[model samples]
Every structure is written in C-alpha cells, then in structure tokens.
Target: MEHCELPRRPGRLDRLRQALPRLFPFLGWWPQVNRRTFKADLWAGLTGAVIVLPQGVAFAAIAGLPPEYGLYAAMVPVVVAALFGSSFHLISGPTTTASLVIFANVSQLAAPGTAEYLHLVLALTLLAGVVKLGLGLARLGGMVNFVSHSVVTGFMAGAAILIATSQLGHFFGLALPRGGSFLETWGALLGQLSAANPWVVAVGAATLACAVVIRRINPRAPALLLAMVAGSLLSLALDGPAHGIALVGALPASLPPLSLPWFDLDTLRTLVPGAVAVAMLGLAEAVSIARAVATRSGQAIDNSQEFIGQGLANIVGSFFSAYATSGSFTRTGVNYDAGGKTPLAAVFSSGFLAAILLLVAPLTAYLPIASMAGVILLVAAGLISVPAIRHIVRTDRGEAGVLAATFLATLFVELQFAIYAGVILSLLLYLRRTSHPHFITLAPDPASPHRALVNIRRSPQAECPQLKILRLDGSIFFGAVNHIAEELHRIVAQSPEQCHILILGSGINFIDAGGCHMLFHEAGAMKLSGREIFFCSLKSEVMELLRRGGCLARIGAGNVFKDKSTAISGIVARLDPERCACCHLRVFDECRARPGGEDVE
Candidate 1:
C-alpha cells in the first residue's frame, strides 16, 4: 500500500462548519460584544431584575404555585432562552397567560400549592418543551400563522378576565374556593363582599393607586416595583399579620435549586393534552413577541431557532425548579427601550435577579398577598386590548365571530378547548369559502380590435352556439371538485345543443389529484356521449400534475391548447358542420373563415 496518509485529518474550521447547525447561536455574538455594550447590557439587566421581582410573585400566585417558583422561572430559563434564541432583546420567563393556563389545568387534578400540583406543573413543562423542540427541529415555524390574530386576541382577553377573576379573593382578603367557574367565582365574591379584611383591602387599593400615580408621574420609572415596596411598608405599618393579612413567605434559596420533573407514566399521560395546548400557546406568544421587538431593532428573527430556544428553556428550567415559560412582551419592550445590545442582556438579567434575590428574599415575609394581587390585576387589565377588539369587530364580521366564540369558550369551557374551538371554527369557515369557487362563463368580446376573452355577463358578447367556454377562478382540490363538477353539469343540462366544451384554465391556480381525476372522468364521459372537451392556458404546474397523473393522455393531449385563440380555432373545426352553418354568432376570428363567415356589423 502506498504511504499516502488517509486524506489529512479535517481541521477545526472544517469540523466547525459541518457542526454549525448543532452549535449554540450565542457563540456568533461573542465577537460583537465590547466594553460599551457590556455596560449597556448590565444596566438593562438591572432594570429587568427589578421589574421581574413583583412580576414573578404575581405570576406564581396566578399559576397556583408558591411565590418563589416565579422568581426561579426568571432564572435558568431566561439565560437558556437568550443564549439559544435568535432575538437579541427577547427575555423569557413565566407569563400571565401561561400561568393562568397552568392554574386552570393542574388545579383541576390537585390542590393549588400542594406537592402533587407542583409535580403535574413540572410534567407539563417537560412535555411542552419536548413538543416545542420537535416543532423547531422539524422546521414548522410557519405553523403559527394558522392561528388567526383575532383568535389570539380573543383568547388572551378571556384569559385576562379569568386572571382578574382569580385574584379577586386575594385582593379582597376573602378566602375563595379554588377552580370555580368564572360566573361562580363572581357569584361567590358577591356573597362574601362584606366579609373582606379591611386591612388587606386597604393594602391592595393603596398599592394599585400608587402604581397608577407613579406611572403617570414618570412613565419609565419602576412603578410596579416601587408600588410593591410601598405596599410592603404599608403592611408593616398596619401590623399586617396582626390584621389577618397573609404574606408571601421568604424564598427558600436565592439560587435555582436542582429538581426533577415528574416522569410517572400516569402523570405524563394525564398532562399530555394540556402540555400540547401549553406548548402551542407559549410558542405563539414567544414568536409573536420576538418578531414585534425585531421590527423596532431592525433584526431578522429565525422563528425555528426561537422555538428551539423556548423548548430548551422550559426543558432545562423544569430540572431547576422553574415552570413552563415564554418570551415576555413587556420585558422585551423594556429591554429594547433600555438599549440592550445583545443576548448577553438577558443573561445578565437572570444573573442580577439571582444576586438581588439574596438581598430581598427575606423581605418577602412582609410582602402582602393583596399587594401581589394588585400588581397582577394591573397586568391582567393590560392584556385586554379594547382598541384591537373594536378594530377587528368593525373591519371583519368573520374575524369578530371567531373572537366572540373564543372569548366565550375560554370563560365557560376549559382553556385548552377554547384554543381548539377557535382553530376548528376558522378552518371550517375557510373550507366553506374555498369549496365554492367562482365559475365564470367567458365570451370573446366584439368591441376589442384584437378579440379578448371577457366575462359573458360583464360584456354581453355573443358566444358560439355549439361551444360553452368557462373560466374556473380558483384551485380545484378535493374540497372544490364536487362543486366544480355540479356547476359544469348544470351548464351542460341547460344548453344540451352545446356539445363542445372549452375551459380557459389561466385562472386555475392549482389542481390536486382529485381535480385531475375529475377532469379525466368528465372528458371520458363527454367522449362517450359523442362530444369533445378541451382545456387552454393551463398553468405549467397544473399541466405537469395532469401529465404525471396520466390525465392528459386519457383526456387526449391533442385536445389541450396553449391559448384562447388556438383553442377556439381548433374547437371550431370540430363543431357540427350543420350547427356552424345555422349559427349566426361568428364570435371568433377563426369562425369567420368558416360557414358563418362575416364579421359583426
């Protein structure tokens, strides 16, 4: 054997190129980071940390988990999502919608705040992560487009109402039965209004009023965090525990502790359906928020990569005592406003959150539940977009119907069912519209110098006595084939003497197998009945499909024409000689050379 070394071992650069897709995206940004950007990221991170403390507790309360779990969610998941995700400003953590869904689903199976409830929530996080990762890897980023914006707005509006409803008892200091329906929850509140603890109600009201006033004073200030601090100090002044007010306990640890998601077969089976709903909703939220922020930053977002980042965040977070999370619209806007330059801003945010928690965790022992409720109530209110709702309702009846249906379903039925209902309804309406494509009859116009095909009804032009020309103005798939066939049959039945048929297929954008089979069979039937059928201006893609389906051969390739002029001339040559002689309408230039040989006066 020749002593030639088996092709020189691949260099690091060559190996790196081969492994590009598998590598973390943050590696590419490392070179872009500099001192000024690092300083900007640190300040942005600090702002994010302050913003999340109140939010984390509020969201956790909504999710039926301990207050600390919310803080934990903002930790590892935020870092992982930023490092792997495509958006520079997107910050991932627990969100209002996700939290509400978690409480709605898991609370049905186990008591809120119980160990069993935590396990179910963790399982859902794990399963949802797996599904999200699969969708990303499969490159189904465009799948989210199927979810209409109207449906999303309606669903969120409904969730927002539910969130506000769920917080009423805490805000009012009344102990409410968990998992009650919306109407039932309100009914219960009505009966217990007089029993609310005055001290707790005062704390909640003052916190809410303070947040509002502070926002008005300085739009960019830490209104949520400052209002919460004010509420905590007020509670201390009112002797909160002595006044029968409940406090969110101090966190057990500042660090995200190691944990394992519930992997029990029974638990996984139970949570699978909910996990799917959570994954889809979270993915939609993350992608939409990312793209919206990208518009401001002039950054191009990779939707599939975002899906992968979200999946990994939730998956990794599940093992570190965090719940399912998605990109935060509010936090991302804040990051962009604060001039964050890179994904490192998000990484710094989580780090700062952990460091700050060490100093503030013990202070939470004085943080009233009512104060968290007030902040959450504000968030819930923001979720409902009245202007957007009005726009949808005014501009589109179909979209309005979807919004109403989803909103009602979310309030009355289970949250996941609401998503399914909206999707199915929209799809059904779409199918109904597509199944009945326009079947326009066309004729050659006499007014034009060069004969032009125009709608018969529009121009009132004469058509050949022995040939019926039609233009199908839509795709012909399984759904529309029957409608098309019935229309053709009706036209034929009405004009039995018109034995020759020509289809102008320029308007047929697509034709599936069912469409091809339909044309083939119709051609065979016409041939059997001593008639002929022809098609002209068929698109190349449609022609190729017909050819591949063996339809073109069965229908006779000779009968397929390239243009209206050619098709008219060829079909005219085949028309009954006696009919052509008797016919007065010499509608085509080719027809003038035949029996009806004069141009229109």
Candidate 2:
C-alpha cells in the first residue's frame, strides 16, 4: 500500500500569536523556560535583589521617603520594566539622580514622610507614566537624538560630583544642611569639618577602599555587597552609636502594597512640574543606556517600545507604593556581563528580587547608612568617564563648550533648567554651523595630471575665461541662502571677465524656496549680462526644484548637462568665437581643436 505524502502545515498563525505578545510584552518570555534557564534566571535575579538592598534604602532616603518605599520602588517597577522593555539587560529601578531630583523638587511643597508627600510622589509617578506613554504612542523616540552626547556627558559628570557631595554628610557623619546647592554643600562641609565623627568616617573610608580594591583585582567581585558587609561589621565592632554614627533602621518584611495616587486637582498641579522633570531624566537615562548596550550587542532596540515599558513600569509601580523608576546603568551593565540572553533575564531578576526580599528583608536593617554612602560614592565615580570627557574636550571645541556649560549649569542652576540650557545651546551651535555652507570656487589641479583634485579657498591656479566652476557643499536651505548668494556674487565680481558659470551641483543635497529664489535671481542676472548659467551633475531632487520654480526654462534646458565633459563641450560650442580668438588662455581640450586656438606659447 502506497502511503500518501503528508501536506506541510504553515505556522503563520503560530508565529503571529508569538509576535502578538511582543507589543504587550508579558507573554513574550513566558515560553522560553527550562530547568537550566530557570536556575540561571533565579541566580541573576538574586544577584540584582541583593544589589538593591542597600541601594533601595539609600535612594528612598534621598527621595525624602521612608526606607521601605525604596524597596517598594525596586520591587514592582523592576518586574514591569523587565516584562515590557525591549532590552534583554535593562533592569529598571530607583536611580540616585532621579531620587535626589524628586526630593529637591517635591519637598518644597509637602513635608517629607507625611501622607500628603506620599500622595504627591504617587501623583508625580502617575503623571510621568502618562507623559512617557503619550510620547511612546506618538512615536517621539527620535526626541532622544535632540539630546546631544556632550550634554549627557556633561550632565552625568556634574551629577557624579553632586552624588559624591550629597553623600558627604553620611560619609563623614556630619549634621550637614540638607537640600543645599553643590557649592553650598561644599561650603557647609568645610564649615562643619570640625563636627565630623571619626567612627562613621572610618567606616565609609574603609568601605570605599575595600570596594575599590575588590573591583580592581576582580571586577566580578560583589564589591558593593562586600563593602556594605565590611562597613556593617566595622560599625558593629566599634558599636556605631557610641561614636555618633547613624544606621539604617529595621526594614519592612512585606511586599509593596497596592495603592492609588491622590486625585485632587491642586495636588496634580503641584506635582506636574516635578513629574515632568522626573520623566525627562528617567527617559534620558534609560534610552541612553539601552542604546549603548544595543550598539555593543548588535540588537535593534525600539525607543518607542522602551518608552512604553518605562511608562507602564512607573504607572504600575506607583500603585504598588513605588516612586518613579528608571533604567539603572549599573544593573544593566551587570545584566549584560552576567550573560543574560534575553529580557527573560531581567524578568527573572525581578522574580529573584521578590523571593530574596521575602528571605532577606530583616537583614537590611543591619546595613549602615555610611556603607550605602560608600556605594553611592563608587557609583558617582563610575559616572565620570575621564577618557570620554577628554575625547570630547580634544575633538570638538563647540561641543566641549556646551559640555562645560551644561556641567556648570546642572550644578549651580535647577536640574530641569540645566537640561534645557544644554539642549538650547546644542541647537544654537548646530544652526550656527549649518547657516553658512561651504561655497568654494573649483579649478582643475595643476599638480595632478588627471585634473581631478578641487581646491577650496586657496587656489593659485588660473580659471577658464568663459566658464567659472563652483562647488556648493551643503544644503541650500533658507538659513544658508544669504551666505551662498553673497559668495556667488563675490565669485562673479572677482572674475568679471568669465561671464559663463557652471555649478558642480553634486554637493547640493537640498534646496529650499529661499535658496531656489536666490539661484533664480542669480541666473537671471547672469543672463542679463549676456552670459549663461549652467549646472553639471545636478541631482534629480534639485533638478525638480529648479524645474518647478521655472529656473530651468529661464536658464535654458540646453545649459544643463549630466557630465563635466558634455558641459565643457556644449559651453565651448556656444563661446563667443570673437572673444576666444583674442584670448591667450586655453583652459579646455575643446579650445585646442578650435580654428583660432593655438597652444599657449
């Protein structure tokens, strides 16, 4: 009996079903499970959770919230970010900068640790989520491009300094004034130098030294955790309270509780500004880190998707008693280094954190504030990329200026305003550079036998008597129209004898209405002078612009050519033979073939 061949079934529907959850993201990584992966994910998650223990409490303190809130922020937001975000390694949680900014802005309106303050924090988180979600839905992912690399570099450098400085009170165990500017903090530290507690200072110094050494010798070492452990032991050895040292008190054992943001209009109005600041900073940090990792991994990350993920994370987290959450560069780097293969690793990290929290919540009370300060110091040090800063300074002066300005502004001025300043400066500098396109007169090279090399600004070479060749090397937009027009007029004035002009239009990438008008007027002027304007190797887009503007008709279609040789030949044929007979210069091969043409004696 012959068996009939089985028909192949298409898995189109199956593939579609698999892809559907990628947009929502909760279902994307659920299917990729095995014993090995589960174990790996569990370990990665535990590592992340352990890492956040001290960090969560410290960040919460910085944000003017109770210690538990920091843990709360880390718990729910992390899970949401991992589930929804596109990056395999990007773990979202409380960041020091975001926390500090939140405290500085929100503390002005409400008392810290009060119910009103918590409500405001929730409102800020919700608003930030809404803004981020709106941006993602609007496909404004390209907004990140508007933030210059220099601005980020500068801002991060300033933030590093600020972070380090902010921890000085705990680092030295000094009762320093809170919420002061960077300079003010430094001044306060100097003024209160005599009040520094030796025991706290010793713990912080020891922690920092240990972390530094461990990181240098073996980067894989859990330096932060180890340093915290060392500091805590040192504090206990000295009986920290006896030496006027502060400790992080008992932490709550429960998971984040479900809550809603206050719905008062006045509360919303008060929280909006801070929420905007938080959203901007959070998105910047997250998107920058994601892009950096994406570049190295050869993975395409959707910024819009990232925005949505972060927005959802924050929104979900707010209800779960979490403050604003953002991408953590440190954790992301760790995730990548740990060989995390996909977003599942991040999701697993969240799961691990939740499980670890259940077991290790009580142990966090023993972690000293000085030890956390030491970790913050280490993080601050990491933020200042000396090599990258040096490269920026050496390569581009304009960018360096912007970087310096942003750095200073972020330190002295409001953080939001500083970012705005950097963006504005970046745009201004860009406009200044592009407003004057390079308009160079081109001549055949005498040194090169092939006559291919074109000179700009400085050319000792002679020009052809009839045709003047120019290269316009930039977009001919409205901003550049005046500069180009002036340059063209100047070129014509300098070479009055050369009546015909041939523009090598290959470099003219774009032409606006103003630029087209200027070109038309120039062509008209040349024609009135009994000469013709020609374009060789003109791009089709520019040609269309000229055609639509009726420039080609006025300049004559015969004047336009596709190649240099064709243009030279055509111009030679139309040359005033009477003028050519008396002309001693022979600039073209066609001139040598003319009846009156003779080799230059």
Candidate 3:
C-alpha cells in the first residue's frame, strides 16, 4: 500500500518554468503580444521618445548632470523597468523631483557635475536600488504607506520653488552661483536685476510665453520642445551668443557608456542617509504613479514587482552612465494616452531615443540655456497644485500641520533631514489619532420601532435605567489602554446609577495584551462596586486576541456575547427587580419583560 515513490528531483525544464516568471515578469503577458498591439505600441513609443528629448535635458540640468545622462537614464532604465515591472504602461525615466533630490543631497559632499560628484551620485543610485530591491524581495511594498501623502506634496512644493530658484541665473541672464541657498540665490538675483541682459531675458520670456500658450491651446502638443526651438531661433536671429547668451553646447553622439559607482566605506558612510531618503522618495513616487495609471488601464499592479523593476532599473542603469531613475508621471501618462497596449512600448521608446540622440546630438549646440530655464520654470510651476494644497489645508488640521512642517523643512533645512522630520511627524500624528479612540454613549433610537441602539447625544433618546451601552471606535493597545480606561472610569462616574455596562465592540479594530489586561482588571473593579462589564458584537480577530491574552477567561466568558440579541436578553435578565418595577426608561425591546419571566403590560 505504501508504494508512493519519493518525488523525483524536478528536471531543469521544470525548474526553469517555475523560476523564469519571477525573474522576468513579462512572461505573464508576453503571450498576448500581437500585430495589432505592436502597431499601437510603436505609435506610443514614438510619441514618448519625442517628448523625453526636452524633459531629459531639463531634468539633467536640474540634477547638475550633463544632458546626455538624462537621455541615458531614459534608455536602459526604461527598458529594464518595462521588462520587469507589473504595470502594463509605467514608463520609468529621469524625473524632476528625483533630480532635485540628487542635486540637493550630493551637492553638499562634492561640487555638482564634478567627476567625484558623479561617482557619489552613482553610489547613491546603487544604494537606493539595492534598498528597493531588498524591500521588494521581502515583499514590504506596504512600507511606502508610512510616508504620508502630505509629506510628499509639501516636499514637491518646496522643491518646485528650489528648481525655479536654481534656474534664476539663466532665466534672468544673470551670473548667479550654482548651489546657493534659495534666499541667497534670490538676493543675488535681486542684486543683479539692474545688470540683467535684455537679449537673454527676451529669449527666456518668449520661450515661457510660447510654451504656456501652446499648452493651453493644445494639451497634446510637445510644448516645451516647440517653445525651446522657438526661443533658439529668436536667440540666433538676435545674435544672442555674441550678446553673452549661454548655449547648451553639442552633446555626445553615442549610447550610454559603462560606468561604476563608488563603494568605499567613507563614501558609503557619507552618502547612506541621503541614499535612504532618495530610495524612499523614489519608491513612493514610482508606486503611486503606477497605481494611479493602473486604475485607468484596469490592470492590477503587483506593488512588490513594481519595486523590483524600479530597483533593477536604477541598479542596472548605473552601470550604463545613468543616474537614479524612476517612474515619470508625464511620460507614463503620455504612453497610456497615446494608446500603449503593453510594456513593449517602453522598450521601443528606449530604442527610438537612442537612435534620435545619435542623429541629433549636434543640434543641441544651438539650444540656449535661457530657453531651457524657461522650460524648467514652467515645469517647476506645474509642481504646485493649488487645489491639492488647498484641500490639504482645509480638510484635516493635523495633516495640515504635517504638510506645513514638511514644506518649511524642505525649504530651510537639508533635504534628507526634511524627509526625516516629515516622516517622524507623520508617525506622531498617526499615533495621536490612534491612541485616542472615540467612545460614544448609546441608547435605543426613539424613532425605530425595534428600538435599535443609536448615539445618545445625537438622537437624545431613552436608555435602560439599570444598564449602559457604549460604542468604541478605535484600536485598544498599550499606548491607548490608559485613554480607554479613563473614558470607562468617567462614564461610570457620570452615570453611577447604571450599574451594568455593555460595550458594543463592533468598531474595535484591534486589542493588544495591555488592552485585554486593562479590560480584565476593570471588570474585576466593576464587580467590587456592585456592577458588571459585558462585551458584545466584537470582531472575530479582536475576540481571538482577547482569548489569547487570557483576559476573556479572567473577565468571565459568560459576560461576553457573540451577538446583540443574546447580550440584550442576558444583560436585561440580570437587572434588579426593584429597579424594573419603578423604571420609566425601558429602552430595549427586552425591557418589556419584568425581572421574572412574566411580561409587563
């Protein structure tokens, strides 16, 4: 009968089938790729390729890297992210926010755009990628939730201002120093306002005005690119170069070359904190964009898989002259809107960008820096969502405080420290909320024929004279047990005549050891005072927690009811006969019965 042979070791083919999907998640959807999808992806890819030309250069300028690095990031990272990411249409590339973070953090250690600085940036990228990959592998994608949305929003607003300030020199045709504080930059700009060059200012103003009008007129147009071209033609026509207008210069006509990130202990120690901040911010940005787009695409995103894809992008792209990269809202949105049907669109985008860079590398020499500034200013202005900010400011005072703190810190302090401050404040605010749950005194609804319970304060209805009911609306844990205990004590003090207490525990989400212990001890104390504590309508998980904590048994399992009907009948049966005889507050349907089995007229 025991003829079952031990399972044979899986063959190589079997193992490959098991592991390949995890390694390359595209396998899940690659089978669906067809001729119709290919044509759609090709069109989407072409459109994205055109748009990234201006964005890549602008993003690179923000990061203090050569424009080529931005295009390079657009290539390898885009392909890698598309190949492995769970989102069908997420297009990863250099982003303005991540670029700002790079400049803000790394500029402190080394001068921006220096060889050593580039190395450090690469190290930061590698570290962030490694951290992300580790998190993905561990399936801790939910960790991003701890970084409050308000924190990110405030940081973006502050970073937007910083981006505009950084470009002020080119925008106004002044010789402002790079990496200056926002106040210092503004002071310098004001100081040099009288010396501003008319030609450069005109180019920037024309570019900004053109981009704005084009964007308003046709939202689908490549406004930044067209505006840059217009500004370039105007600058050349006015002989702006001879008039001291700076040009972007020619770019390298090649693909991304091999590179290495610094890994020495001193470098790691110096850059670790900033790298962690970068990783957190990038993960938040990438995952949020993926989820937002996935809603429209009707595709389920595996968040951990998205993390893995982003991690791989940065890690692999670092070896290809790319700085840190992540999902771009603009590019991803364009890809989806342009009818991208699969991840192949991203791969085609990389190929097209590589081809375009090689072909048009020389034309960039005519691209004026002031025009780029105009484009960047528009991008920075885009970051300030007045509506989102207004909503946050009005809805929740605590969240508003968190937003204010993050915004101020991002403006006044080190960028990494600002992130830390915001995250810490978010956790504190969250704890403040969770630790103070609401306790509502409940009574029978006067309007309901069945006498269902309702909030006593809002409904102003009659309650049982010998018993009181309460509804708790939060978790009960060590940090909150004291608060709950005080509320329980206060309820008793105010209504001592109601000697029996019934807690409607349906709203209780969790109960920890301390909470269970406090309930047990309170039950004993209540019995000593000629009263009883009962619990009803508790969730199963909370009930299990109480049982496991030994509090349920110590408090007497008979005092806990699985449903309201049993609790009402059982609790009403224990009320004093003398109280019932004279009681006018017969609030429960069970109150119709006398203390004995007989019904009252």
Candidate 4:
C-alpha cells in the first residue's frame, strides 16, 4: 500500500503571519535601515536626549518620585515601546499628565517621597500594565474612541492648574504641605506670602525668564536645560541649601537595577481602580499621538499593537524602578523634526539617555528644586492649550458643557472619578442628540425635475389630501424608536381624514427589532382605522431586517413599495372616488386623465 501524505497545514504559517509583525514591529523597518538612516537617527536621538534630560527630572518631581526613576523610565520603556510599537517617530517616557495623575492618586495613599509611596507606585504600574495587556489581547483598543476630545481638553486644563498649584511652594519657597487640596494650598500660600524666601523666588524667576527669552529667540536651543543650568549656578552663588532653597540632591548614576513590584493582595486591591484609569489615559495619549504623527508620515498604525507595546513598556519599567509613563508629544515632535527616519531613532534615544545619565546624574545635586519648579510651570502652561480650549468652547455648546463639567470635576473630585465622569457625560450627550431625529414633512415640488420632494415648510406646496408623506433622517434603533413612534402618531392624529401614509425610507440607514416591532404595530393600528401605511425606497439592509423579523409579513408585502411612482399610482387607484372628486389640486398623473380634473404636474 502506498504511504498517504496528510494535507499541509497552514496553521503555523497563519499564526506566524499574524504574530511576527505584532510581536516585533521593528521588523517592518529593518529593510529600510541603512548608513544614511543611521546617521539621521543618530542626530535625532541626540536632539531627543537633550530635550528629555530636564523634562525627565521635572516630571519626576511632579510624580513625587526620585529623579533617577524618571531617567529609568526614559531608558527601558523608551526602548521597549520603540521596538514593539507601530509608530516610527513616537518617543515614550515620563510625561506630565501621567505624572500628575500618579501623584494625585498615590499621594492620597501614602506620604509623597516615602518608601510606601514608591511601593504603591510600583504596584500601580504593574496593575496598569496587566490591564492594558489584557485589553490588547482582547482586541479592545478601540475603547479609546469613547474618550472625547473635549474631555481631554478639560482634563488637561484642570490638571495643569493642579500642577501649577503643587509647584507653587517650591517656586516661592513657602514650605507648603505636600498633596494639599487646590483651595487649601492656595489658602496656605496666601497666609505665608510674607515669609517667602527672596533668594529662591529670584532663582525661579531667573530660570523662567531665561527659558522664555531663549525659546523666543531660538525654539530649538534646549531652553529648559539652559534655564536650569543658569538657576543652578545662581543657587550655587547664593549657597542656596543654607539659604533655605531646596535642591534635588544627587541621583544614582548606575543602570536601573531589577526588582519586583510588591504583590500583596491588599496592595493590588487598593491600586486596582487607579491602575484602570491610568491604563486608559495612557493608551489614549499614546494612540492619539501615534495617529497624529502618522498622518504627517503617511504611515498606517495598528492601535492594538500600540496597546501591547505600552503594556509591555510599563510592565518592564516597573521592575526597573520606573513609575507609569506614556508617549511624550514634545519628544515625539522633536524626533520627527530632527530627521528621525525609523523606529531605531527611539532606540538610539534610549541609549543616549542611558549614557547621559551615567555622566550627569551626580551633577543634578546643583539643580535647585525651584528651577525644576519653573521648568514644570512652563510645562503646565503648555498643557492648557488655549487654542484647543477656545475652539471647543466657541464651536459647540454640548461639547462645552462636557468640557466645563470635566474641568470642574477634575478640580474637586478624585482624578479617577473625574475621568469616569467626563466619559459618562460625553456619552450621555451623544445619546441625547441622536435620540430625537429631524422629522421632515415632504411635499411634491413641480419646479424640480421628476417632481422631486421638498420640505413642506420650505416650499409651501399643496400636499395630497388622502395621503401624508414623511422623511425620518436617522437610524431606527431602540433608543430612537419611542420618539419616532410618537412623531408618527402625532402626524396621523393631526390628519385623521388622510387615511393613507407614505414614508420615504431612503433616509433610514439602520433598523433593529424594536424599530421593526414599532412599524408592525403602527401598520396594524392604521389598518384598524380604515387606513393603510406604505414604505418607499427601503434600503436593502432595512428590508432584510424587516423580513427576517417577520414584520414585513404582518404588515403585508403589498404595502411595501420599492419606488415612489408605483406607490403613488397604487395609492391613487385605491383612493375613494368621492374624495378624488372633492380634491381641488390634482398632483397625481392619474388625476390629470380623470373627467373634470385639474393637473399641477
């Protein structure tokens, strides 16, 4: 007997095809890498490193984490995101929004800058990564769509205010308590204005002034770094540590050491809510930045793969003593502008950051906390995005409501609750808008070709006395069925003498079981009243739904009209001859041929 060969299995090949690109997104760019690309990426990476140094330190202060943790965040997470993410120029690291949120949530559980706080932050990062990884594996990356642009704008503006408030004590040397409410912080600052240290205030003001002047003269001149250097030198000149000016002190110079996040059940339980909020906010920030950059590069992005990359970055980062991080818009824009040609540029940035930390971490002791405050203040100002806020407020009232509500909630409520509230309000507003569609009464206009239908209110033309025509220009989903039913009932009640009705179904794009049942019941009610209902130009999908739901059978196939001409002719033929004799305006073609008839068409 001849040996039988089993059919070749494509199972492995199919899995490979789907898994390779997702697991190693960098593989797609490998063929494009060359000597020229390397040189471009090198320069871009150099620029990115310079930009992130001061920013990382300032963001670390914002998160109430050690300055070294920020540097570590820029290392592992940056490399991991670049290797696994779908974007060519997006740079991931410590960002202001994530930092602010981390401080807000974690500060409530433990004192800022304590061992307990650090452990809690680690737990939060790990939990968030797990959540993000689960969402990516489930292919639920599209959940970001529900986070409206208005919510982000409002949340950022609110968070920016909080950032400024948090740094005020450092800016003015007032020694305000950590993690105070916005109002309490302001109140405390007000009572201690007379005790402000002039030396620290001068240093902060000088740093802010330098940053502004340099940025105005040359936008690419690393203004934050220069300003911080000037402030540090001024603090040294004044011997600031003795003069009550706080300093960041020395940061570790070695590579990030491995450590596990605390896995106590109670710790995980306490952090679960915060972790969920951070994961959503971080993913939205990453995907939005990626898509925006890809629009310029004309590159396609896989949102699910981005989610996975971010998840892995945070998960890996937690073990390296890094807190929660996300995409940095500033670094990403600089990377693209500085001629980053591939994802390799981001990898090179991480390498450059690691090398820079080795050389400069000890020197951070000279960097005064006041200067960091000034730099972060600039960052906070940038986050407000006046143009975006103004545009949202000026254009749409509903969106403005969402923005205001979110902004207020962020100011008064917990950060997690603020985010959830904003999302919920946005969805409610969207549903409210769609629940009531425009109900248009249409009449035949003789001036147009084919006697096209026009709004009765606009054209003011005589309509058929024996029939009523209406156009519903929205979906017939469950949410909208009640409103549509009431409108249809009102129209019939207004014209009881008009026993037949015609619905122009061309405007309807979708219909569900609720909508089908509504139509079936309406048809039955009409038939009982010695009247009839007809649908013209029903969409194929809507007709299929009606048929499959058995509504078409109950309503009768003869009542379903595929075209206006056939529907008009059939309805006119069935009209009482007595009523036709009483009609003054004969709009139908059949009426023109009748004895003693007047024709408008």
RMSD vs true structure, all candidates: 5.7, 4.1, 5.0, 5.3
Clashing pairs in 3: none
Candidate 1 off by > 4 Å: 1-22, 27-67, 87-91, 95-131, 170-175, 192-249, 260-301, 323-345, 363-375, 386-391, 394-396, 445-451, 456-464, 529-531, 572-599
> Best by lDDT, which number?
1
Per-residue CA lDDT of model 3 for 1-601, tens digit only, reads 6898898999999999999999999998899899989887887787678667767887898998987889899999999999989998889999876898988889998898899888888889999899888889999887666667678678667767876787788888898976677788898999999999988999999999998998789865556667878999998899988998888776677899999776789888988888787787788778766765665578987889988999999899889989999888677766775678999999999998888778976776788888878877886776666777899899999888998998898788866466568789999999999999989988888578777888878888877878888989998999999999999999899998999999999989888888889988998899899899999999999999888888888778899998877898999888898889787656677777776324444
Q: For model 1, where is the 10-residue window of minimal lDDT?
A: 592-601
What lDDT would each prediction earn against the true structure? 0.84, 0.80, 0.84, 0.83
How much is 423 displaced in model 2, in angstroms?
2.1
How high a TM-score does candidate 1 get? 0.78
Error of 1 at 292 (Å): 7.4
Candidate 3: clashing residue pairs, number: 0
Q: What is the lDDT of residue 103 in candidate 3?
A: 87
TM-scores for every candidate against the unseen true structure = 0.78, 0.86, 0.82, 0.82
Residue-wise lDDT of candidate 1 within 115-206, one digit each (tens)?
Answer: 98898898899999999999999989877666677777787688778878988999999988876899999999999999999999999999
Superior candidate under TM-score, 2 versus 3: 2
TM-score of decoy 3: 0.82
Across 5-85, the per-residue lDDT of candidate 4 in tens digits comes to: 999778988989888866788887889999989888887787677667766877888899887788888889999888988
TM accuracy, model 2: 0.86
